[model samples]
Each structure stands twice: as structure tokens, then as C-alpha cells.
Target: MLSAVSRALLGALMLSVAAVAAQAQDFPNRPITIVLPYPPGASTEQVARMIQPVMQERLKQPVVIENKPGGNGSIGTLAVARSAPDGHTILLTTNALMTIVPHVQTMPFDPLKDFVPLTTAIRGILGIAVNPNVPAKNVAEFVAYAKANPKKVHFGTAGIGSPQHMAGLLLNREAGIDLVHVPYKGGGPAVNDAMGGHIQAVIATVSSVIGQHKSGLLRIIGIGEKERFAGQPDIQAIAETVPGFEATSWLAFYAPAGTPKAAVDVLNRELVFALNTPEVKQKLFDLGLPVVADKPEELDRRTRSDLKLWGDIAREMNVRAE
Candidate 1:
């Protein structure tokens, strides 16, 4: 008893539903490429490589890591954004690039709208370290020293608008001290400069500075995370001295928006399984990214939470990439 027009629309809707089911059933019909938007050999890249084999085995597809490093992780991110949402292509990215930097830089694709998070598998920890030559031993002591020396106490970060930069700026604003910031091409170079005494302090990954901290080359005065890292319990959290302080970054997997929910669920299952693998878990810890492996919904919730937190920090602090 339906009208002809209504019958045609119903048929189209049924066909669309069937097509989605078929697509999900045939997911990863070919190879799966994880686009890493950072340079090779960085922790982000290392994480992708570490999980590649496990995912390949579980998904029964050739999982390849395509490095598309540039524009502070935007060039490759955009490429994935524009890719087919058939679950064949995914982006392995961070909170800094997704939530923090987006507030300051105009992007070709909307981060919050263009991607669907699969899961958050790991998080990066940041630390504040100073040259052994610096007299400060703890964050409180360091703040006092910075207040006395003013711009004389220079701090280096991986780059402008990076998580390290955010951490440094928060310290400056809260402690009411002027710690001159020197941006570097990478965290390694920033930490190296601090080690050589070219800069008084450097904000970088806890993993990057841990060896030097143990070697007596530099001292980790405080950790940017709310609590101390499990591996390094001796280091003090910055919040111990500066109330409510935390600057951390998490790496999550995402597919272009409109990717089928079934495909996303499949990818999330495999991604979480890969991360929890004993070998992958130990390596990630060694690399200084503690395993999170949260659900897709949790990843989405965390992203929204960080957008509000870091967005406020970036705006109030006037942090910008350009």
C-alpha cells in the first residue's frame, strides 16, 4: 500500500544497510596502512613499528607504516583524513597534534570532526630537567633560582606549540618567573643542549632524559605528570610544588570520519590486543610511553577533555605555532 516514491526510498535505504554490513565483513580486504605523521625513529614511529607485526597477524593483512612526516604532523594527518574510510588507512597520532596545536594553527581538516578515534594505546610522559651545573635540586628550588636569575635561566623544548613548550609556559606563568624558551628541531637536540649547559633547563620526554639523569649529566628537577612515573619513582611531580600541574600527551589510533562503526570496532579490538601483547607492552614502557589501551569511547572522552584543558592553556598563554 506504499506510494511509488516511498517504495524507491525504502529500497535505497535497505541497499545502503546491506552495503555497510558487507564492507565490515570484508574489512582490511587488502593491506592496512598506518600513516605516522612524525619523522622516522621518533617514539611515535617506534610505537607504530612495535605494533605492526601483531596487528598484521591478528588482522591477517600486511600492515605497513608509511612515514609522512611534515608540518608538525599535519601533512600526513590530512592525507589520512582525505583517505577512504574503509578501515584500510589509519592515523597513529598524539594529543598535542590533535587537540593542542589545532587551537593555534589553521588546519586543512577539522581534527575533532574529520577523524573517529579507534583507541588510545599509550601515553607520553614529560619531565623538567636542568643541567647539572644548575644549582636547583627540586621544582621549588628551581622556581626560586629562576626568579633570581630571570631570563638568565633558559629552557629548551622540542618546538613551539609542542607539549614541552606548553609545560614550560605553564611553569613560567604559575611560578611567576621568566625562563627564556629556546625551540629546537627535536627533543633529542633540546635535551642535548641542556646537557651541554647551553640551556639551563629543557622540557622533554621522561624517556629522553632518564639516562642522562642517571648518568649525573643532568638532573630531573620535576615531572610534568600529576604522579611520578612507575619506572622512576624517585622523580617528583611538578604539581607537588605547583598546584594542579599536569602536561601529558597520549597517542591514539583514528580513521577518517564516516568510517563504518563495525570496521572501527574491529580495528579497535586488534589495536588493543596488539598493545597488550607482552613484547609490545615492555618495549613501549622502555620507550617511555606507558600503556593506556583505553576503549574507543574512552579515547573520545579523553580527546574532548584535553581539547578543553590544553585549548585553555594555549589560548590564555598565547601559545602559537606560527
Candidate 2:
């Protein structure tokens, strides 16, 4: 009787392993959805659109993009979390939604817990841009102007929990000036508002406003990286003025937690292939984003590290949502 019980347990374990393997093999039998947490025209959406065709061709299944914008990207992120772990649904979002937003607002899903980071697609630095009509030409001038105007100078961002929002907050503290925060549903609108002179400044992904910056519609005075962007060295680093200020962000891909290992592997392999394509690389470079195309483990490590770093910073800054 003892031997029979042991044999039965072994059989059960074997069945479980076989079931998981089968699930992985059959993954993406249906259409795959890549959920965009923000509205159309954001950098995240552009990234998704760039890779969708390649992914579909490689996976041999239709991949659709779904936009669900609100709650600083928590709503769409949570939808992916609650989805089946069969790898049919994925998420394309910025690191801010994972690292900074959760610290400011009560997130419906835990970014680190509820999703598996597939890979980092592209990396870009945050930039500070103002309308051409603004008198400030650089970070120092901007700070002095803000000091004189105090809370009247309105600064906009993609959203309250965005990396831009945190960068703006840190600028206010480090520069010893007050600039009111304005949260937009997406980066596209915020940049537009700045170009239209409705807002005094905006901290956004360089990709979103580089075209306008070159056209004189908006002037990018400072980048939030520790050093100036190599592609556009004319703009000084915000750190040069504020000291120790940085807000680098990445566009990453994710699947729901508990997804089959095989499925995750397939997605990672194909998506990396798509990002490495020459056409895609050129487009990203033109938009001021450097192709990261890192492995799944790399993204996992970054997500964990950034989560801790941003969480502490959020608390120290006492950053509240808009």
C-alpha cells in the first residue's frame, strides 16, 4: 500500500508537467492583444504599432492593439493582470507606470507581482521642453523664471504618476522654485499644449516632441539624464542645473504572471527579433530613442530595481497624484 501511494503521487506530478508543456505548445492559438494604457499617439502606442506587424508575421497569429487609458495607466495594466495566463494578452507601457505611478496612487494591480516583464524594447531619456515663446532658454533661466513666478508657472506631464511628473517635482524641490503640475491623459496632448503656449513647460519622452523641437514649436532646454543625449548634445542635462537629478524611462513589454514559460520564451524571442530589424531601428533613432532590445531577465532586474528606487523617492518627495 505504501508503494502504491508513492507511485500515485509520481503519476500526478508527471501529469501536471505534461499539462504545462501542452499549454505552452498551444499558446497564441487565438488573436493576441497588446494593451496600451494611454490613449493613441503616445510613444508607447507608437512602439506597439512598430512591432505589431513583425510579431504577427513571426507568431502566425493576429496581434491587435487595445487602448485603455485612465488612472495613470493602472486600468489597462490591471486588465492585463486579470487576463488568462495563456499569453494571448500582453501590455506595452513605460517604466513610469510600473515604478512611479504605484507610489503616487493606489494601483489596482501590483506591477511587480501581477505581470511578467517580457523585455525592454527601447530606451529614452526624459526632456524638459517649453514653448518657443517662453523667455527661458535653458534650465537655469527656467528655474529663475519659475522662482519669480512661483506657482503660476504650470508644468505638464503625461500623467500625475509619470516619470515626468516625478522629475518636475524633483526640479521644484532641488531648484527651490514652485511650478504647478498639470496632468494630461497622454504625452501627445501635453506636448501639444506646450507648443500651443497653453502650458509653460513639459517633461516628456524625447520621442514625442523631438520633431516639434526641431521645428521651433517647442524648445527642449534640458534632458533629465545624468548627461546630455548623445544624439542631441546641444541640450544640457537637467542634472547640470539641479544636481543629482535623473529620470530615464524605457518602453517595455509584459505578460500576465503565471504565463507558461514556453509562451513567454516565444514572445521574447520574436519581439527581440522585431526590435532588432533595421527599419525599426532607424525609426527609433530618428525619434531619439535608442534600441534596448534586452532579454526578459534584464527587464525583470530593471523593474525590480526601479520599483524600489522610485518607491523611496516618491515617499521622500511626498508626491501626490493630480
Candidate 3:
């Protein structure tokens, strides 16, 4: 006969084991929907398309990717939060949706608790690209020029609360310069405006700026990564000049809270397999994504850390809703 306290502890352990087994059994029986907060052509959308077939094959159900491109990604993200916890619907989005936008606006759901972490779907490096005729040739020169001419160097972004906008703001803070932010509807338009020489600079994803850099339409000043990119070894990271400076655009998958542990595990296993494929890896590399795959726990840690990081930045920089 066991003591009362020991009996209760033993019963709790059994219940926990039973719960784990039960969750693993009833997951992923139907179609899954991946909600993309950005438009179809965005990097996060592209990654969703890349992994769908792989996930479908593993889960034995078609994965549908739905585009909900508005409100700087809060609208779509909130939809996922309010969705059922059946594991059939997941929000696939960048850090901006969870970490940046909420600091600047009123959101419908809590970023920390409303969702279950699935995985970090992808990670991309940021690059500061400017028009060909900009006076600055490198990051140092660009900073100096912007310092000398405050509010004259026009920096365009997708919009306020966007990663690009935050990147611009972070750059301004680090460089101690004031560059006018020219917001656009999307990254494509922002890059177009920069290429047209309407804006002096744009902090965009490496993939978006690489082709233009190759075509001589824009000049690649520096990347916001720890090292040089494999595709473009000529351009160095911005951190080379500004120590402790690094910014990235990453996509992750999240299910509504209370999603079965089985479903999360299945999805995480399938996603990890998809990310390791040769074709997927090559495409991500070509697109300037660093191709980092994380476990659900790691993603949770990252999301929490980044939320605090960006939240602090938003407060310090006085970034407000547009």
C-alpha cells in the first residue's frame, strides 16, 4: 500500500502518460489549411507552397494555403487564433505578425499564448539595397550621407509595422540618422519605387534585391546577417560595420491553442523532413533564405525572445501606428 501523497503523484504521472499517447493517435485525419498573412508572391507564401506537397504526402491529406494579405498581417493571424484547435488550420507567417505589429497596434489575440508552436518554416536574410545613383557606395558611406542630410534620404518599406519598416527604423537608430520612411502597399511596390530612384534606399529581403543587383538596377550595400551569403559573396554583412547588428525575416507555423500534441508532433516531423529535402534546400538557398529548421520548443523560445526584442525596439524608437 502506498502513502496518500505517493498515490496521488503516481496517478498524476499515469494521467500524463495517457494524455500524451491519446494525443498522438487522433491527429491530422483531415485536410489542413495554412493561412499566409502576406500576398502570394511573398517569401513566406513561397515557403508555404514549397512544404505543402511534402506535408500532404506525410499527413495523407491535402494542405491548402490561403492568402490573407492585410493589416500588416494581423488580420490573417487573428483569424488563425480564433480558429478551431483541430490542427487543420495553421498560421504561416513572419516575425512581423507576432513580434512587430502587435507592439504598434491593438491585436485581437495574445501572441504568447493564443497559438501552439509548430515550427520555424524558414529564415531569410535582410539586405539594404539602394538605387544605382545613390551617393553612398557602402554601409558606412550611406550612414554618413544620411547623417549629413537628415530626412533627405528617402527609405521605402512595405508599410509601417512591417519588418522592412522596422529594419529601416533599427538602421536609423544604429546609425543615428533620420531618413524619411516612404511606405508602400507591398515589398514589390517598395522595391519598384526604390529601383525607379524615387527613394534613396530600401531595406528588403536578399532574394528581392539580388536580381536587381545582378541586373544593375540597384546596388547592394550590405546584408544584415552574420556572414556573407552563398549566392552573393561579394556583399558583406552590415554587422561588419555596426557591431551587434543583425536582422532577419523568418516564417513559422502556429496552430490555435489546444491543438492536439499528436498533431503538432506529426506536423513538426513532416516539416523537418520537407525542409531537409535537396530541392527545397536549394530553392531556399537560391532565394537567400538561410534554411534553418527548428523544433517546436525552439520556435517557442525564439518567438518569445524576438517578441521582447522587437517590443523594446519599438518603444525605444518611438515607432507608432501609421
The candidate scoring highest on lDDT is 1
Indicate whether candidate 2 or candidate 3 has the larger lDDT: 2
Per-model TM values vs. the true structure = 0.96, 0.87, 0.90
What is the alpha-carbon lDDT for the whole of candidate 1? Answer: 0.89
Clashes of each: 0, 0, 0
| Candidate 2 off by > 4 Å | 25-28, 133-135, 144-153, 184-189, 192-199
Per residue, candidate 3 scores C-alpha lDDT tens digits across 1-322 of 9999999999999999887677568577678899988777877778888888887887788999999978667778889998988788999888988888889888878888899999997777788999989987888998888888988999888788788888888888777889899888778898999999989888888888889999999998998887777788999888888777778878888999998877888878888899888899889888888677889999999999989888998999788886
lDDT of 2 by residue, 50-162 (tens): 98899889888999999999866788989999999888999999888888878887888888889998989888778999988789999999998888999999989977777
Off by over 4 Å in 1: none
RMSD of 2: 2.7
TM-score, predicted candidate 1 vs. hidden true structure: 0.96
Error of 2 at 290 (Å): 2.5
Best by TM-score: 1
CA lDDT of each prediction against the hidden true structure: 0.89, 0.87, 0.85
TM-score of 2: 0.87
Per residue, candidate 1 scores C-alpha lDDT tens digits across 1-322 of: 9999999999999999998898889887999999989888877788898899998888889999999999878899999999998889999988888888888788777877999999997888999999998999999999999999988999999888888898888888877889998999888899889999999999988888899999999999888888888878899999999988888878899999999999999999899899999999998888788999988889999999988878888889787775
Superposed by TM-score, candidate 2 places the C-alpha of residue 95 at a distance from the truth, in angstroms, of 2.2
Model 1: which residue pairs collide?
Answer: none
